[model samples]
Target: MTKKTQPKSGSEIFVPLNMLKKSPHNVRKTGHTAAEIEGLAASIAANGMLQNLVVEPERDGEGRETGHYFVTIGEGRRLAQLLRVKRRQIKKTDLIRCVLDTEHDAHEISLAENVIRLSMHPADEFDAFALLHNEKGMAADDIAARFGVTPAVVKQRLKLAAVSPALMALYREGGMSLEQVMAFTLTNDHARQQEVWQGLGWDKGADAIRRALTEGQVDADDRRARFVGPDAYLAAGGVITRDLFDDENGGYFADPGLLDRLVLSRLEQEAQAVRAEGWAWVMVTPEFDFRATSAMRRVYPSEPELSAKAQRRMEKQEAEYRELETVADNEPMTEAMKARVDRLEAEMEALRGQPVYGPADIAAGGAFVSLGYDGGVRVERGFIRKEDEAPAAQRREREPEPSEGREGSAALPERLVAQLTAQRTAALREAVASRPDIAFIAVVHAFVASTFYFGNRVSCLDVTVRTVYLSGHAAGIDESPQGRACSDRQAELAKLLPAEVEDLWDALLGFTQEQLMRLLAHCAALTFDAVVRPGSTSSPPLKHAEALSQAVSLDMAAHWQPTAANHLGRVTKAAIVEAVREGVSEEAAAQLADLKKPAMAEAAERLLADKGWLPQVLRLTQKASARMLAA
Candidate 1:
């Protein structure tokens, strides 16, 4: 190994012309303008240069230091001095006044000079924050005070600097907003950050930030779910607690599977109560997924366990109700007079059908009769209780008269079918016309296509439909010449056609009239079944582990029962009304149980309803039910 040696006090310094050359410390030009070298020369000709140059020591021609150095700073002044001496205005032998600093001190001086004079660009400000905080170890608050900016502003700039350089370029160009910048700061994931940046188009306004926030929240929640798996969460650390739940009538959930089991077990119990009571069962899980604000869906024909606990209090209430129902049933001279005469009947039933009806029995019976009157006469067990209530002129049991005109004329499935069909046809026609390349033949074909319901499938020429997305990019619209032609033509056609034309085209693309009719038939069966038992997307009695697992994993709206049932109801109705005049099959109608449960069906149904297909929905359910029964 060689021995180390200290640098010489006056070393032979040689700096390349292009490498670490010195320049004047005093700024010769303001802003971005070039220096006025000619003006400096004229000034030097009038008077010898005022300042001496600064430099590192250098060797002589023989390559010896000679205790001399070359100019490193004030180079312009030195050049001016040389020119003055050559013109005989200054003596060549004059010794220059030189001031020198160490290299470290020189660096600090360079930074200080620029800091005092330079006005920073936004990009520069952002970079400066990163350098100060990350490289120079300055505190953010300190930097903020030094820069005369808020801590938030400094923090935001640092965050902005963290964004991919490509995205920051967009921000600097005015294509992105401060709100979006703040939103982008919420995540460190690169792909998600890019996704948000592109999703917010150039024209996105301040309101777009709310949408970004929502998306960010959704992403953050998904990440949380992945990070906090249910089992791992319960394992790390937890405390079991007790609360005064209405005198300790609370429920229990045990082990990792308890939360997963809650919805199905709760629903099964709810269903049993409904069957016993002859009331419809409804289960709603509001938070269904993981929305922070989501609450459990309130079940109606509420679950016995979840409902107010039936303490002695509720038992006493039920006992009172049973007594009232009995009083109404047995003590009536006329049903209207039963309530008024209940005690009198209790007293008189022992006296062999005593006809002493009291005021109370009269009032109670009158109320019962009032509640159950079939037009005028009240019938109980197929007979009128009082001749006075139904005048002798109308005492005979009246058969439901045949409808004079149309049955439920205002709300008939057939009328709804007509309206929807017309609407769909108009939408299809408009769609075709709006596209420049869409010939009249295409429009007619589309309208004709829409007249048939496609449900989830359609065929265009030979383009067999698998999925139809309303909001999606069109194929063949890239940067190539062919793509450009197709896009420009499509745009021109859109400009030429009526605005509704695109909607009509989309309608055509979605389904044919024939498909709609079949779908309507399916809807009728599902809705009727739902009305009777309200089975979810999955078949009723959803007990299998797979089904239960799916329900829990899915969003609440994605709960198989209600969401599937709801979609079947809506789509079926739309199909039926649209194809009502097209005439659906009365034979061999299909049950709509084939659709996947715990899927996107809820979102689709909501979208369809928003587009106005409620009437068609009713008709489809009826027709499909009628067909199913016939089959």
Candidate 2:
């Protein structure tokens, strides 16, 4: 006798809609929402069921066929079809395709269909979306409608698909993360994207990748872009690349050159208007470094008297502001009231524009017109460049007459005066050295002058204060404890110091002896150095810095502790291991030997923290004794 063969698990069969029943063993506990069912129903009506339902044969207790099927999977599709039938869009007796299976348990079939199936990777989905839109000629809206997603999502997925094929391949191979791959889409240059990927090697993160991709591009939210406005940029034929996936402030302007040109042109127009005011010259630039203006003399703008009407308005505003303050003190202030107060203050300020320069001063001085950080035009007037100064005034400043009632007063050369001042300076130094308290005050004064009154001759003391810019990059230099301590000390001194330079001496005399010493120590501390200049083969100054640190018994460990951001991340694997060994233990260093650079760096940072290990540059040198000359 021949035996009958059973059907495969996925064998297709047609079943009437009325004959199907929802299975109680369905894994998905939640019922479909009306909107979801409607969407599914619409999709089915448009393209028919894309997937066959999984149904098992219903059997009676005697193991006889009941002529009904239980849906172990695809219950959502069943509900959708039922809704369609209820809406009369399809007949209740219509046949639906289904997979016939009864050998497996109902629960097993439901779980396998819902839980065991893996969703498509996002990269593959992106590529598939692109393929449908590009090769199949489907509009974004049509694709979105078919997939039950918004058009914006479809467009974003298409954008992701536009990334370099090489980068996408890396993403597929698990070599890069989704975010890191998304950063490459900022630019469409495949060669550049690959170059950046290789340059980053294994160290770069998503933010770094985005920064590299937008190197020459300006953020659309930048002050210059805001000032120029997007409409103007696009009208000028400048391109902008947007990131739809992430919130990057409307994306980046791809043509920074054009943006800069627009900024300069606008500034030039502003300068031309200022030049018409009878100034000697009007200079325009996007950025103006105050350091560059040190050599020039600043002529203060004379405050112009307000008109009678304006004075009345100002007085009224001031009275209102006072009233608001009193009310705020007694009761809570509303946002609208605060805004009104701010507007009043702004109007008062506008009425008091720049001081009016006299005709003569205007003729001798020029103006600098630039864009402020807020995107508004900033005009600095009445700055007299040295070359533009009158010849008579220049002569008077250059020439000095001999004073009477002094030895050799008839004619003393400039060199002799310099020599005399040099001697005086040396004597002052010796006096200050003997009195450490005064020496401390002097150092503190110099520090304050450099930190707060930078590029200005504002010190009452005869000491010369130099303002030094680091000019070389150092990791975590700003966040170091030493930096924070100095900043705090500066803030305290700034509060104590008199606003006017003439009152500085009196202010210094008021400080207690202990306060004076602490200020002096801080000031002297600023003089210490371990800076390495760029392109320098040897740092002779660093040797002296070590000596100075030793002289003061500098405890750098108290102010600094190594971290990944400041030290470990900046060095090689070998260097990190050595740092860890010196700062922690040999065993700790050994534990980090096999880690990747980033992980090793992090481990080293944590191990070295609070271990009191100083880099060679930060170590103090031994104190040297002075030798007496033999007679």
Candidate 3:
């Protein structure tokens, strides 16, 4: 008898491929996809099978060896090797590495292999990719090929590796999401990344984090940035910040101050060209200001009648077109005939286009050079300064040309002004909503001014202001929070009044002063219209609304938060980014600078919520409410 040693258990074996069989006791039931098998085959062909299949011996009822093994853990991998043999990449008899388990149950082995693994953490994978690039000196494309990923994915992973190490640890500990991690990649400055991360709330979202990090930079599509094209700005030594996570948002100009200088330089150069056209003076501005330009005088270029040759060509083309018309009514025109009509129309139009400007009349006028809507140089020629306006002697001779908008008024950004003012009105309405003191003051003021002043038309105090129908221009105005509160208050007050008009005076006499004042305040609040009608000014009511707003310490943030449906979505991208900078951080706004209008507005709404951000029209010169409340 030999000395009995415990037979080696769970031994590794090089099993012949044909002897491997699918195990009925294996845990996984879902069949492998064809593509999964193909990818596995490709991975195996390149890497030579990195893992072993777990197996156990196959036996009959008498516990006799059946000359085969049942695969437990890696049926998928076994299938891939079979595919390789079918493709002639390997032979069916090729030996495959496997673990032969005799003591452990087959299903338990399969479950352990399948369930005991965790996918590599994103930070780890990112670092591994970075190691390939930084240590191994591998390019993105080469690393991508080795890892079965696209070059862009490799590049992104590498960039994520460059994020602040502290942030990576947070990600590892499961404190931050992959989206939030991607946001940190907008800037390469680790200190900034750490600072922004530390300052934000734990739940701060990706867009908010991105905006805060990018606030100091100008967006690539900013008017000034675009005016100085990215290539030129870079050539001029401007820096740019790129985010690999969101290529759609584009890059940001890290040097906004530098871009502005470049923009003004370009605008001044454009002004010099305008000056050469013999204008008295040329004014350069980054953009037109309505208040600054509204009082100026504008002159027109003298339109000369067409020359004799042009008139003759137009007449001839008209005759030829009539001839073609008669033939076309009978039959379709040949290509040559159509070409003749086109050529005749072109020649005639070219002749008609020759309306020469008499430069002599425009010499007295100067140009206002500024940036246009899409960032091109805009030159408005023949705009005379107020002092340079035509003398009354000359003005009486020529007919005054009709101009767009009121004479001497600058063009307005009508939609933006109205939208902002409407939001302000909503906030103001809420502020005055509960104040009975303001209503009492207005009523007393109106009575004294109207009763004492003999010949006065009305007091500058518009105490009896008219109610505005807001739904026409303000979307969802009727359903606004402020609007609903006012409606509820009004309805409640209405129920207290006598049903018949004859009994109203008796009922009011019976009520407490507080109850009467509540009714008065509700009535006054209904007429509180602070909206600036689009394309027109509402000065008195608006001015009065601001004064009343201070009395209540109106904190609009309590009543309003920016949403795509409300404020940001209605404004320009520039406005949206500016709000982000004011409410969040400059870096955050910078991240949004490159986004199209819709995305920028939505991002702004997220960043500005509960941040005390208010539009220009809604902002007060001072937080009178806060100061008084402190008192």
Best of the candidates, lDDT: 2
Q: Global CA lDDT of candidate 3, please?
A: 0.72
Ranking by TM-score: 2, 3, 1
RMSD of each: 30.3, 11.0, 20.1
Model 3 residue 54 lDDT? Answer: 82
Candidate 1, residue 62: Cα displacement in angstroms equals 76
Name the candidate, 2 or 3, with the larger TM-score value: 2
lDDT of 3 at 515: 81
Candidate 1 residue-wise lDDT, 515-580, digit = tens: 434433332322222222234464453334334334334222221222234344345533432322
Ranking by lDDT: 2, 3, 1
> Which lDDT values do the candidates have, in the order given?
0.40, 0.74, 0.72
Model 3 scores a TM of: 0.48
Please provide TM-scores, in order, for all candidate models, with all chains considered together: 0.22, 0.51, 0.48
Give one digit per residue, the lDDT tens place, for model 3 in 1-631: 9986533557778889999999999888889888678768766876788988888888999999797889988899999999989989889999999987888887887888888998988888999989889999999987765555668888899889999998899999998899888988888899999877766543367866876777778877776777888887889998777776546346888888889889889999888877887777788977653334344544344334677876887788899899998999999999999998899888877766643324543565667787765668867665555576544125334456578544334455668667776898788666656776554444533432232221233433455433344665664454455655654564456546532233444565567768866765665565567777778775877888888878776777777788886888888778887889889998888888666675567667877878888887776656675676686
Model 2 poorest ten-residue lDDT run = 622-631
